[model samples]
Target: MHLLIAWCGFVGAWLLFAGPIYQAATELEEEGFERDAFSAQIDTVEVPERPSPWWWLLPPVGYVLQRRRQTEYRRRIMAVMTQDQLERMVAFANTATGWLFVAGGAFFIALKETWELAEVYELSVLLFVLAVVVMFALCALHTIVRLRGTHQMLARSGTARNRDSMTDEPPATSDA
Candidate 1:
């Protein structure tokens, strides 16, 4: 019964992921978005004009390729963001990572291999504690970074408001 439940969850996850992947691939084939996303995702080898019926999977293959691009894209995005943004993201990731580890442990325990854990209680305790510490540290960092960002934004807005108040309002123009 446990195995059946796991299989069902796996299938459900595949279906959940398939819809978006299919839509993205279809859009890529349709040339809806920029050509680069399509090209980046697609296999480098060019397809022949009269390919076999088995070639129907080319776009699906491209979908897999597109998914692979996410890591590099995220790195680029992180590089360009302000310090505040980076801190918030890191904090979020820290907390999320802790939870994911917990979830992974839960999943492992639920599966057949959990019997092995009975003898390794120390390892489990150590890992769980480490995850919790990292999560808490991230939470503290998040608070500090958020407070700084808020102060910076408030200062900029206050100056802008002062300058605007100092300037005379433009006279309204009537359309002919």
Candidate 2:
């Protein structure tokens, strides 16, 4: 999923912004505009004096925010846990949840030219929003399940006063 989002987002950015610039420049040249002079003027523009690539920061920013949110949410769900178990849950949630963004972004870019620009934009926005909502819902569900399991494990351990009470014991008992 992360790969999908990254690949799509990169392609979308290139198509939506870079493609238009090239297209417009090509159009101008074809219409007998002073192509060489215009190219020279653009080339003379100082890159350092221009604005930075602030937009590039968005993906990581979004990823960080989403990861943080998922971590906090999982923490809430797995409220009853040892420190190590909680940390593992947080790590899993952070890595897994972040991939959805990448996948959705890739899907957005792939469909950009297949639809109108407005439609593409709307679809991309909707996809991202849906990704976030779904991730949240899934995370919440996972947390609930994990917490319930933990509760059951603790309850069983607490009530096991004799070897006869081990009827529900399983072969594996890892916290995960």
Candidate 3:
């Protein structure tokens, strides 16, 4: 009973705040990255591929390992990737956040039930399913709110990159 209440509270807080928390953290991390990136020699720029769907199947352990890989990949990419590429990857990860929550919650419940750490297995599963639904809804809505700004930034950087290559002289206007 007490465990269930605690779990519910955690889920509620996550639904209400996780998206903004993720966005803020990523934004802050980007600041330092931008600084170091300017000085670094760029021999190669390797864009990261999205992970395969097999991740969720491994349940609890897979999530941790996948996250570690994600961090490593992000760090590596930030060292050389363009602003548009970095932000686009971040946005894609943001969109996938809800599944991480769902996998984590469900895996916890499964582990607890297997070890007899908690009772009421059926109810726990049901609650977690509902929580997953709520998480998906909240994250989707948050993504919608944030997508435009991220996309605009990407567009700006892309245009800037293209403009940087052009000759300084302005394009001649056609005579009317």
**Best model per TM-score:** 3
Q: Return the TM-score for candidate 1, rounded to 2 decimals.
A: 0.27
In model 3, what are the clashing residue pairs, if there are any?
Answer: none
Candidate 3 residue lDDT tens string, 1-176:
86776566555555445545445445544544444444352435454565666877878767876787788765875766777757765665665575466545654544443333224343566665665566556655676666667778999999998888674677889999
- 155 Cα displacement, candidate 3 (Å): 6.9
What TM-score fits each model?
0.27, 0.25, 0.28
Can you write out model 2's per-residue Cα lDDT over 1-176, one digit (the tens) per residue?
Answer: 65555556544643453333333333333444343544554465433222235634797866666666666654444454546655654555554455445444544554443234334345576765554445345534654565567668878877775554667566786798
Ranked candidates (TM-score, high to low): 3, 1, 2
Query: Weakest 10 consecutive residues, lDDT, candidate 3?
Result: 111-120
For model 3, state the Cα shift of residue 169 in Å: 20
Total clashing pairs for each candidate = 0, 5, 0
Alpha-carbon local distance difference test for all models: 0.50, 0.50, 0.58
Quote the lDDT for 70 in model 3. Answer: 82
Q: What's the lDDT for residue 31 in model 1?
A: 35
Model 1 stretches with alpha carbons more than 4 Å out: 1-122, 169-176
Model 3: C-alpha RMSD to truth?
13.1
Predicted candidate 2, C-alpha RMSD = 24.5
